[model samples]
Target: MSSISNRIEQISSSKPGAKDYINYLHSLSAAADLISYAKAIIQIPDGAIVARPVLAEFVSYTKGLADAREEVLIATLDVLKEKTIIFEEQEFLAREALAEVYEQKNEFTKAARVLQGMRLDSGQQHITDDQKVAVYVRIVRMLLEDEDDAGAETYLNKCALLIHKCNDPAQKVHFKLSQARIFDTRRKFLDATRKYYEMSLEEAVDADDRLQCLLAASKTAILSPAGPLRQRVLTALYKDERSVQLPTFKVLEQLYENRILDQEDVKQFAEMLEPHQLALMGDGVTVLHRAVLEHNLLAISRVFSCISFPRVAALLGMELTQAEDTIANMIIQGRLSGRIDQVSGFVYFDSEKSNLNVRQKALVRLDEVAERIAATSRDVRIY
Candidate 1:
């Protein structure tokens, strides 16, 4: 310990050459003296020579030194692992430095793991709320970068618990953005759209960020199941004067107007959505395709009081059986106030009943369309 401790003092007081200090640390690392080296640094006094700043400088110096950079970081982390109870700042910085190495290498999940390795809830360290929030936010972002929403969510939950206590606007925005992203990835389009829309309205977030959030809002809104609840979010986005500038604005308008979305239109809008948003559902059709098909059926209901199954299938560009099934589902869910005349191969719509609360009254022959809309993925925007 005295060896490294005296060397740190020598370097700290004299500002020794980078080569000399780096070479010495490299030697210690090569000799497997990691524990001693780390302890020497942690053992430094806090009053005249604080552990926080000195540990930060030590970690900073090791970065980009090529051969021993990551090795030194890991060594420091190992030494401080169980001692975070006392050397919390040193351990945090050590882990952060190692995580940065992983980040630079594009190993996002590994970076997130290294960051979350800290025992934030152990209560042994005096880590402030802001510090904990910062760590949680970083872990969430890194996990998101890897497209691991479930993992990201675990950390975001920790942030949510303390977000109100956080004073930094940037961190708060990060927490909101991560939450919205998780909502989106999990196919909760309506909830995601609402969060993104809310973030867009925040002046605290810069214009580009706000614009991206608005675009995300519109995309999620378009992807949302065609329903009155989703329409509210779509309407709000379309009415946002600033939304007019977005390419997604037109799709949002179409969704708001309940107009049938064409294949070309869906294709264009699908271009902006994430792969998961376009992921195939159990029905062997993409989510966007499913949403568009249902939306078109809703449009059809508005125009025709009664439509033949063949005509509905032709209009929806799908098989007659699929059209019948889709319409039967809408009717049963009370999303469309209609009944299927299986014998006549036609669907009859009730304009008045369509306006009534779904649970207020069950339409005629509810069991005739016995197939219930599967609750396969409730994490989706619409329940």
Candidate 2:
């Protein structure tokens, strides 16, 4: 220990460069003398040029030390920042290390602030776009972890711009996935679903990533507010060949076909979901429960012109009042085109008229085609 302290003192007194400082720090780390090294680094004069790299190296070396003190690490970083001109890249690295330590210590706001101070342009293109992307991603994650969705989104946009500058396909996909997650966090399910679905189609994305994206898209589509837009998105996903073999495909198909989703089916599907997927989609039990109700309502709209409230309740496995409330909510949301008659205790489906109108329009189009064909035949005969 005396020898190690002597070596550190000699290195610090000599005004070492970055390489020399790093080498000495590695020796201390290898000797398991990080405490002595940390004390020596902190004692270096604040304006000493050697202090920059020494403090940066101190931050890195002490980072993984289970017993390393936070104050020592932070004080080292503060000195590194003071000598920014000589530090340059070392300053960035030191700040990043400091931020990471803050995060590990659960000081998320401090972590975010440390990273936010790192200006990518300071390196003047010396820093790779990938590095810029990485920093922005960290900041976004920290902000998000701190429950600052709006702040995370601001960094998300910045990260996006840097992503385009990078040549790494993986980095681009990473940014996209992060962006989709932000949308998900914001409860913009449609936007999140669209992003995921689009990513699933990208040939550049790896198969595993594509599969995950498709699964996310399908789940978010299910969670999207029930509407024609939701139906269109689900239909597209249902027809996607890549999704056909995934376990979630069946759930999507069942929902798209307006088939009642049974508890057993949902349990089977839930078992297939990844832990993150299940968490992101919320409680699988409740999700399936709601899906069953939605499926029954949709099926009723498509099949039955009129049904007694008791029958509706039986089909949905809910009581009369519960069924009435669910159906009424669906109706008000424009998910179910129907009305309930309190006096008659009957629910009438009005979507059938719309279906009839669609068929009539198709018939009129066919008649127009027939008339055009006849006109063309007469013209040929006259010629």
The most accurate candidate by TM-score is 1
After superposition, candidate 2 runs with Cα above 4 Å error: 1-23, 30-75, 81-88, 98-130, 142-151, 157-168, 271-288, 352-383
Best by lDDT: 1
- TM for candidate 2 is 0.71
Q: Compute the lDDT of residue 3 as modeled in candidate 1.
A: 67
What are the per-residue Cα lDDT tens digits for candidate 2 across 1-383?
A: 57666776687567665577578666553423665564455455434466655665566666665545455556545655544565567668767877877898888988999899886786532788888888888888888777677888999898877777887776777777778888877767789899999899889988897898998898778766665567889889998888786777777887788776666777787676434334433423344355556666777778888999899888777877878877888877766777789899998988655633344568878999999999998888542
- How do the predictions measure up, each by TM-score? 0.81, 0.71
Task: Give the per-residue lDDT digits (tens) of candidate 1, residues 270-336.
Answer: 7887889889999899888888888888888888999999999988889988898888887677566
Whole-model lDDT values for every prediction: 0.78, 0.72
